[model samples]
Target: MTKEIFDDIFGKGNSNWQKVSFLRRCFFNDNGITVNWRANTPLIKLWKQAKDLDEFKVLLKKDKDAQKLQFTHEWLKTADKDYDQYLASIIKETATMQYDVWSDAGSVKVGNAQFSFLISHNNGDGHAIAAVFKNEKDFISSPMKFITSVEGTFNIYDYDCGQNVIVTLNGRYDVYVYCGITCFVKK
Candidate 1:
């Protein structure tokens, strides 16, 4: 009877029966039979292999270059909605930037100010910078440029400098200021 239900749900032989395991034992009583079975499908197998959500996230990040697998309609019917939503959000955030050439690393918002971080690669080297914006047409501070390196490692930190917001970029090379530069603001 359990096999019949499994076959009906998984379309008979679609899943590996040898790998399928039971989560609970079948009990018989006047109330009839109760069996708890877990199907070790590729999706379920991946979920079980992860120790926790953070580990799952790391796995997803590492798998970004590989082909993505999604839940089937049948699985979605019984899958955890919270887990599904969490996966969707992770995919959305990670999909926002590409790593090869240029990317928007991320942004931080402090009160009414916003700091945007960007990374650009050129001639086999990469540089990262932070741009501060006050409203849409003004600049609170000059763009802060970090060190350049072949690895393109960069990070941004925000702090309050007197009454103004200061964004600092940490990278591989020595820091220098490029002031009095012609800047263009795109609407």
Candidate 2:
């Protein structure tokens, strides 16, 4: 029994005895409690939200581990307050090229802060991570990779950017693209 029930029946003097007998009670005295003990509480919510078992498993796995990705084509999608765009110039530049690097990214911005994530498939891909700053040089056509954790999320900090400036993800050596999402909050 739980401590609450045990205490009510035998009084507080039985507390130590309850602890001493916990293993035996768990093993043979209570079948219902034993069965529920190993149950995962989050799985119930996951099952409710999921369309099927396969989708449920996918959601569980995404939570349990980071996924790997590969990029073979390059494109850019960007957004600010007034407009969002697919940069045609970058799309044209990467059209004739092929990128074969293992890469992954998923970023979300909240309020004035943006959380970034990226991962290189391996070290052989000839690229380095750099932050996409507000003011970039003339020949720098894309945002370079920035520092990230091993699992790919960036270390949280105040990101520097201008209100009207455009920031986009780019690979140093090859073509790559990822899904971009934006959410807004009222000041």
Candidate 3:
């Protein structure tokens, strides 16, 4: 029975026997209070919280934990892209020697770059072309592996001019010569 009903039944008189007990009426009671209570109050108090600038400053002390990098590869890919762009910029700096139009016999001396390339008619041996990319393994070098002869993809690891190609990061500035196969890059 509720305290109100009990009090109504037996008036609020200090008649000892009429002093009703305030026992737990609700099932989930802490102290005669409902345990399964739900308040309409929201979690965020819009404007009621007191702002303490000084106390906040005191509490917001500098963090002691080092700012460790989390999964640096995510941004590392960005760095890779940046380095790739830088390498591409350097490749552009040297200017591509792509000036092939049709199978013909000729040699080109790249301006101020000390690079030499030739396309010659092997008479009957299909084709025989070679380029002397000096000090230029970045563009062409000595591990000079060929990825594909048909596609004209090639790689070199050393330089005749003692220059380092694919330095710092590998496969940055890819160099290939589509010999005697007219692969001209229009500026």
Candidate 4:
């Protein structure tokens, strides 16, 4: 499709027209027949509002979302139906079917300070663990460190003074604070 035709349907300078044009080329081959087809007003509006290809695909999948757009050509309608089915299959294949549940052990107190812990699975080889201090006072203990019992696995820690401390650990680890307080872990 030419830029002139795209501009006519979706107004000038639309960022998504190139992507839409590419997808149209993949789905529809009848350029001559498409030339005679009028712009579906509701569809044009929806296309203009779509921020990206992903959002446009989502809009196309929802019947209620594109209910106002009337398909004027048989081939255009067929292409849209095929694209929707393709999206559904791809979504099903890539969907996250299971999630890891981490048990919480509340906060641990170390001397005058208390810390709340959170652990997130990285979906790969490691987990990101964060320890947030409950109070606004910095841990005055110099050279604060996170000690884990797992041999050969080291902790990469980032401390934001009195705010929070983050550590990335590989595999299963039992982490403890420098003050001998055990942090929460996945149960």
Alpha-carbon local distance difference test for all models: 0.29, 0.28, 0.26, 0.34
> What does candidate 3's lDDT look like per residue over 1-187, in tens digits?
2334334423335254222222122112234234223432111111112143232222222111101111111222222434223323333343333221222233221211233243232222233222322234324111123322221322221222223332121122322433222121211
lDDT of 2 by residue, 84-164 (tens): 122223322323322222212232211223543333322322322222322222112222222322222223212222122
Write one digit per residue (lDDT tens) for candidate 4, span 1-187.
3435544544425466664554444333333225323454444454556676456555644644243222312223334545433432322332222111222222221111233333222222222223322221211111123443342323323321223223433344343332212332321
Candidate 1 TM-score to native: 0.20
Residues 4-102, candidate 1: write the lDDT tens digits.
543443332446432222211111111213432365444344445667545544454345321133222123323434443443333334332211112
Identify the superior model by lDDT, candidate 1 or candidate 3.
1
Global Cα RMSD, each model: 18.1, 19.7, 29.0, 18.6
Sort the predicted structures by lDDT, highest score first.
4, 1, 2, 3
- Residue 18 alpha-carbon offset, candidate 1, angstroms: 25
TM-score of each: 0.20, 0.17, 0.17, 0.21
Looking at model 3, residue 155 earns an lDDT score of 27
Cα distance off (Å), candidate 3, residue 7: 80
Estimate the lDDT of model 3: 0.26
User: Highest TM-score, which number?
Assistant: 4
User: Candidate 2 — which residues are off by over 4 angstroms?
Assistant: 1-40, 57-121, 128-187
Which residue runs of candidate 1 sit more than 4 Å off their true CA positions?
1-5, 11-67, 72-74, 97-187
- lDDT (Cα) of model 2: 0.28
